[model samples]
Target: MNFDRKYLVWALGYLVAGMCVGLYMAASKNHAQRVAHAHILLVGFAVSFIYGIIHRLWLDRPGKVLATTQFVLHQAAAIVMCVGLLLLYGGVLSEPVLAPVLGAASLGVLLAALLMIWLVRQSGRAEAAA
Candidate 1:
């Protein structure tokens, strides 16, 4: 029910999907889905799990506005990036649209990453001062 648990669940879903993709790729001997498989496993599963762990460990403000911002931005960007990558890799989307979509998604991820860095730095300072 909590935000952290929600992320963990999402990560698990990604992990299952990624595993399925990997299995399919292996069985078919087709590596066209390599990009999607990697992103699904790394960004979707690994990053989300890491995000959940960070939330659980850093209990400064569970669902504060900044936390909410980071969560929403990161999730939105991840979805956008994953979808864009999938479409592009599968030739479902042309370069014109894919370029802008993936570019914006990358920027969004960068912003969210910066916010996380700031949070970690803040926590580090607090711990040091204590």
Candidate 2:
């Protein structure tokens, strides 16, 4: 299987952004701002970069139903987590409801990523067999 350098770049960018956010949070005194920045860096940059890497590296069946389903689930979770973070930062969502919900969405994204990796590995094995 061919490797994509773009995924590496994307992952590095996310790590850098997350680190920057950490620095900013360290300097800030406000709790809310720190929380918001942390979520943005974690979910927006970190999760997104990971997703890009997964998409670039994984070479599963082109039109498989499971592949499509996983992709949709992954994207959907990412979107929801991002939006939820934004809402929380904007003070539109209370922590009691929003934080847990966003956390759950992020978990879904993680699960999807795992499933995609498994599918890609299976496909690679099948190709080797053939």
Candidate 3:
């Protein structure tokens, strides 16, 4: 499948997951998972959807290894971050126990952003060269 379509499909999954969390919070009146829920929507759904658009509209090399890596990294990191936040806020785990996981996930998110910037720059150059 094309990266754009794959990303868009996964984005809908994230949207559902995020919405489930939101509905749970609303019903329970427990906003403890608010941070996790927000991250799931923003990073998992919104960012992935935007990335899909970028790949579809801007990139000619959507199948490039770096693009695959960026997508995988972003999804994995976002999931980890969301899970860690949920564990922390739900009092299932201590901050110290999940600190490393959160930190690495945060760095992974930033790295995905950097990869996206590079990909966009490369796409611009490719257009110019063509």
Clashes of each: 0, 0, 0
Residue-pair clashes, model 2: 0
Which ten residues in a row are the worst by lDDT in model 1? 58-67
lDDT values for all models: 0.83, 0.63, 0.91
Error of 1 at 41 (Å): 1.1
66 Cα displacement, candidate 1 (Å) = 0.7
Candidates' TM-scores? 0.86, 0.59, 0.96
In TM-score terms, candidate 2 sits at: 0.59
User: Which tens-of-lDDT digit does each residue in 90-127 have in candidate 1?
Assistant: 88988798999899998998898888877777777777
| Candidate 3 lDDT | 0.91
Ranked by TM-score, the better of candidates 2 and 3 is 3
Q: Model 2, 3-100: lDDT tens per residue?
A: 23433454465467556656765777445555545655665566556655655656634336666676567657766775676568658978788978
Candidate 3 residue spans exceeding 4 A from truth: none
The 10-residue segment of model 3 with minimum total lDDT is 59-68
- In angstroms, how far off is 17's CA in candidate 3? 0.7
Q: Candidate 2 — worst ten consecutive residues by lDDT sum?
A: 1-10
Tens digits of per-residue lDDT, candidate 3, 22-100, equal 9999999999999999999998999989988998999878447898899899989988998899899889999999999
